[model samples]
Target: MKNLSSNVTERTERRKGEEEQENTEERERLENNRFEDQDETTERARCEWDFHLRTVVSSATAASDALGVIEFGPSGELLATGGIARKIRIYRFSSLVAAASDADGGGGDVALLDHASAYDYYICTPAKLSSLRWRPGAGGRIIGSGDYDGVVTEYDLERRTPVFERDEHGGRRVWSVDYSHWEGCSVMAASGSDDGTMQMWDPRCDGGECVATVRPSATKTSSVCCVEFNPFGGPLVAVGCADRKAYGYDVRKLSDPVLILDGHQKTVTYVRFLDDRTMVSSGTDGCLKLWNIDDARAVRTYKGHVNNRSFVGLSVWRKGGLLGCGSENNQVFVYDKRWGEPIWVRGFEPTGESGCERGFVSSVCWRQVGEEDECTLVAGGSDGALQVFVGTRKPS
Candidate 1:
């Protein structure tokens, strides 16, 4: 009788454990389904956006054609463009809109060709410009640029002259330059170069020498193609390199990278911080990877743009959680952060002209938005064409 009672108790306990396990499995399945539903809703919203071309501007001279980069000022009041023409063109955002409005309801196919009246002023650089960045909290008075001459220069837009210049890459071509506000006040800058190193600079350091330098890896002979400081305010900095990987490091500790994102089959051309804990990296392997630093792996991969080689630009609109990049097919692609597919694709030519076999969209940027219903996108073509697009969501 005692043996029978013990057996009965054991059976009861096992049955209860089995029931709890079944319940847990059911909960997991339901939670996964719930997430799938939410993703579907977000994707539907992304598909409902409509973007239209607002303005078109092209190089004025044949000698200085082929734009490489385009950037908007911190306040979105000014636009700066640079390229193989070795000239930095500055245009007032209001002026571009006024010109567009005067054309045809601000949505004409009219192309402004080297129109002197369209641009406020232009600066001639020593070499082809590769990248442009506007200084943070400077009221659009200062802008920095990287050039093929292997120099990083900061220009005072108010005076139209370079206020600071650094030539430490040994003429190996400075591919990217970015600024960071450290300790809430100290302004620091960084540049990535073909020299396979990213150097940090602080103007207050007295002699203009870079304060620190970080390499991608000790064994890899890869060039540092792009560098980005965390826009959300932190010591975290990331660099994309020719070794087909992106490395994330803390500015306070440069001895080793805290995270390594390694899925690209080709060179990683660009890196942009999506938030404090996540980032997006673009590779010539024809895909964009969304990485979670804590996990030390890519959370998602975004593909649709035709990028196999060349530095097609990558820009993120944090407010909208949208990623914008140029395609080798002379088109612009926009992707929602939650989806792998592109939400929109538009050709650089507004009139649907088909002579783009030799040209591609080399640079793209989304205007930073705040409390606005509409957003602006600017893209640059290899042939020195600039197109501005305005995107808005359709009323549901």
Candidate 2:
């Protein structure tokens, strides 16, 4: 009976060993799969950075004109560009891309999408445009612009006429305008201006009266350069100002800021939301900062772009975790959100050009959609030069 008991114990030990071996092999397979996935993600990010200049087109304005703002329509079908020329030129995206593709094989000649045949129409503004945003849910028919004359105007693109106009900044330049909507609120417009206040307006209100106003800076002379509503939908709005600070506020509470991002040594020129809880701000001190609105702290600082003086432009592509900004050195610098160094840089000068343009790249915008294997980037130079870059996956 003792011998029989020992044999049974040995059999049980063998079964236990087999189970352990199976579990170990399964873990190894899963670990291998995890590594493969990480590798694939790394490779895809590398390919996304391989940007090529697809086309370069100078705006119809004279050589002295500076293109201040560029915005792409929601559907990516239309592009609106405006600047010191006091005109907003609208172009068909397909026409620009097709023209560039046609010139691709012709000795890499840069095709100039001229004003005569390229743009659909140009909207003349009362003053030079400082900012432009396409109103969301407007079916690409409505657009808005903030101008140097301290006015914010919304236009109906279908009718080529102004639909709404407001001039409440007391003749100070209106630097930025943005829109926000929430569950309980109708569409509200916010404008940041040199008058040191951010004002919210509801177009539905009679006489277009200001609904609310928030003064972020303690000093009365502090100019609010940029304003952006949280794109993810909320009462949150961010403002960048000449006080060398940025503020995040819930529209519901206008008296106090929920977050104060203070680090820039110079004027904060732009602010944009990266997500519901995070945002980015640019300053004339030559850096872009990523902030956690919940914690009111900067998580990252992006450098390598020379932006010590003017508004060199700041934009973020959330899908790919990329940040794009213009440099004072007349180049476009793109950075991955995870890294401080630039991943790609492209100069604004076209082929065979003197490269003597006096201004830097003033604005940049990425096509919001079409991220399956490729994407498009539109950059506007202070010299009124518009360049389109296409990023495609590299063949394995």
Best by lDDT: 2
Compose the digit string of candidate 1's lDDT tens values, residues 1-396.
999999999999999999999999999999999999988877574665788887887644554377788888887888899988878899888878777677775345543545366778998788899999988878888889999989888888878888888888889889999988557434888899998999988855543567788887664468999998888888888999998889987888888898889999999999998878889999998999999888877899998999998888999988878899999988899998988889999987732243456678999988885545677888888877888888887787
lDDT string for model 2 (238-295, tens) is: 9999999999888887889988899999999999888787898999989889888889
Q: Model 2: residues >4 Å from true position, as ranges?
A: 1-48, 59-63, 106-109, 350-355
Segments of candidate 1 deviating more than 4 angstroms: 1-46, 60-64, 106-115, 205-207, 350-355
lDDT of 1 at 338: 83
With a 3 Å backbone cut-off (N, CA, C), the pairs that clash in candidate 1 are 60-114
* Worst 10 contiguous positions by lDDT, candidate 1: 106-115
lDDT, residue 288, candidate 1: 96
